[model samples]
Target: MVAKGFTVDLNKPLVFQVGHLGEDYEEWVHQPIVSKEGPRFFESDFWEFLTRTVWWAIPVIWLPVVVWFISMSVKMGHTVPDIVFHSGLRHICVTLMEYSYIVSFSYQTKSYWGNTMHYLLHGCHHKHPMDGLRLVFPPAATAVLLVPFWNLIKLLATPSTAPALFGGGLLGYVMYDCTHYYLHHGQPKKEVAKSLKKYHLNHHFRIQNMGFGITSSFWDRVFGTLPPQGKDVKAR
Candidate 1:
């Protein structure tokens, strides 16, 4: 049975605590709070700090790696134009596949969740919309996921070719992460960014199910998940 006044204890591992809610986590998590901070996933300060990251760190740590990956392709005699064309295509395909997964997962997320599973996946973003530290994917988690991804691309191409394609995809990931942070925190004076910010926030505050596309609403339109606009509506 759930405690009558259950609240998340942020200073400890969250998975066990959230699991205690069983099916109640879905409804409990959607309620938003405006704070610059987020839940601590671990009690140990060292481990807990790994759960958070700043917005600017994305480009600093990854852009050089992106350049290095593309350089490998150059060494194999691939021209700059060929690399750009193929890499750009690969980037687009990866993006489409990503948003497609987001759309599917958006609809299929059940009311019952795995303790802190939903929080880890996306619930925390909704619950604490203004928490800038948690706004982007932490580098630690990204590094972990890249291992299998690094290997997967190798199967589809020779050793010389796979890293170049992966580099394109890496660039796409970097762009996606950077853009997600901007949509939340960027104050746009121009109309286009203002509109994009409005659209992204709509998914957070107005309709969580729609606007699964974070970087642009183009895929949302393609997937038929765009918010209904009679009242104006709008993710990362």
Candidate 2:
């Protein structure tokens, strides 16, 4: 039925029959969405398999590396004010730009490609929002995309300044993924987390196209997609 601008097939199963979790490489190839037991692959087969074991741990591993990178850059005579707000909060501004760009790009991709890319990038998670394994982008897949962004950031900003901005954006992605997982499975102890959980769940089952911002609702507010206020956003 036409709930949003797009038509959704209500009859289709939320978790489609792909294969049993981790049966074989052949079974997992190209399966974007999976059941609760899933660690599905997107376009790359070998890399996804290679990194399947470390998907959830990506934030854990990468965040500390980002910290180290930032720390080293600071030690190289670049102050936090110099690296972080070198051009008056330019670092965070660019980082926000990157974050918004990725969110919009993913949304546009899902909109253009329909179910296939949707399921691959995001729809599956919405379909099975509680599935722990599908919450974050596996490092293998993330690295494939980060290479180009790395080059772009280098060209866009100074060496001393770029890493700080890059690290900030990287941290944003990590927060988005981690916050996403927490929203689904975490019993949030804070009012803010509880509120965000309510907001994200609304995106999944109430307002599909709105509230795309996971880490921060700033963009959603700016872009006029912050989910209708005062409307009931009950969990699905």
* Local accuracy of candidate 1 as per-residue lDDT tens digits, 76-179: 88888878986897789767966875655453233335545667767778878788888888888888888898889888877777767888988888888787
lDDT of 1 at 122: 71
lDDT of each: 0.76, 0.59
Task: Provide the TM-score for each candidate, comma-separated.
Answer: 0.88, 0.69
Error of 2 at 231 (Å): 5.0
Q: Where in model 2 is the C-alpha error above 4 Å?
A: 1-35, 38-56, 86-114, 230-236
Each model's RMSD to truth, in Å?
3.0, 8.0
- Candidate 2's TM-score reads 0.69
Error at 159, model 2, angstroms: 2.1
Worst 10 residues of 2 by lDDT: 18-27
